[model samples]
Target: MVVRRCLVLLVATAAHVGCTYDFDAFMPSGAIDSDLVDDTSSGDAVADDAAAPLDSAIEDVIADANVEASDDVSVETSADTSADTAADTSADASADGSADTGGATDTGLVDTATPDVPVSCPDPEGKALGTHCYFPLAADNWDKAKAGCEARGAHLVTITSAAEEIHVESIRTGKDRWLGLRRPAGSPIGEGSFAWITTESVTFKKWGGGQPSGAGECAVLRAGNDWADLGCKSPRDPICERD
Candidate 1:
């Protein structure tokens, strides 16, 4: 017993009909209503579900990008720091080299190689006389005696004055000693042609009569405290002197 609405039409003229209708009578059971269209909660729910996943995915992508950027920044920062540290080390090495150069320059202050000597001479003889010192010792020959005296920082005695001759004679302990008067084998006559092996000549002579032959001979102290010529190969004591 359902209630219903209907539309009925009666013909009043041959070409027209009067009509009455109830539009609600055509509605089906459970049909959609305009109020139901306004109620869109299920569509809102579906839209929210889709949007939530999309926002979550976008946030995850942003987080991954941030992580990659952070790693890149960290790597770049490490490279920059390593470069700075290497630069500092190079600067330190340069400073050390400069300091070494400074030290080398400072080392020049203490390079003394030679020292000064005194004017006085060293001799175990009695005393120094006339800017010279004398030493008396045994020697082999003219050359060997000269070598020995040179080893003592001296030369064979060269007597230029009578007092020097007497001083040399006074020191003679044994046999005759060699003097520094000498000349080449083939030489000119006169004392001017001879050279004193130990001193500069000032033209003084104390020869014994016809002594000091100018024929390739060396001089020696004779018995009379006078000079005499002798062969150079003969061994004799030497009176060494320093001037």
Candidate 2:
């Protein structure tokens, strides 16, 4: 019994030593596995950090390309606009040139159609008619004077100014000449307010002394600047006319 008890005690001690060694081995293995897991996680974090910069660089490159492309499009659009403006300017210039040419042609046609009329004048001494000058006709009635002047394509001289009256008087013959003087019938002046027979306004007036008496509306200018009021039907010398 003593020998059996000693052997049992020795076996129990050996078994306890074996259990402690196994526990120690298992603890070291678990620590190594945990360290390995932590190292792998740290490596993965570093790799992710390294790839972040690359992603940012790629994004920057893409952004630069997009900006460059947009700039290129803007430049192209500006060039096209410039070209269109130049074309429009050219068209306007062409239209202006065509208008100028057309205007020149029209002026040339107008110049060709209407010829200039020439002016002719006789001696400066006599009164100038339309285009001719003439002396006084023979003494005759007012009607006869009108007829005479009409025949020569002229009318009796209408005296406007004293200077013109003097001029006519200087050119008259010895006989009295009827002038273009008339007044409205039954007027307040009783024919004293005389006007030119041509119906033109009297811008000037010269009456002889002691002439244009009451009821003496009709009048005539003779040589020596002599003016006499007479009836419309009175016979007298008529001045020739010209044009």
Best by TM-score: 2
Best by lDDT: 1
Instruction: Write model 2 residue lDDT over 1-243, tens digit each, in one string.
Output: 443333233334434344323433534544434444455445435445555665677689999999999999999999999999999999998788779897343444434576535434343334554344656676467877887877767788777667666667767766667887877777765333778778878787665666676445567775656777777677776765464
Which residue window of length 10 is worst by lDDT in model 2?
3-12
**Per-residue C-alpha lDDT of model 1 across residues 26-64, encoded as one tens digit per residue:** 546545355444543453454445456556777899999
- Model 2 TM-score, 2 decimals: 0.51
What lDDT score goes with residue 234 in model 1? 87
Q: Which stretches of candidate 2 lie over 4 Å from their true place?
A: 1-64, 67-69, 76-135, 183-193, 201-203, 213-217, 231-235, 240-243
Q: What is the lDDT for 49 in model 1?
A: 51
What pairs collide in candidate 2? 131-243, 132-243, 137-240, 139-237, 140-236, 140-237, 191-217
- CA-lDDT, candidates in order: 0.70, 0.64
Model 2: lDDT equals 0.64
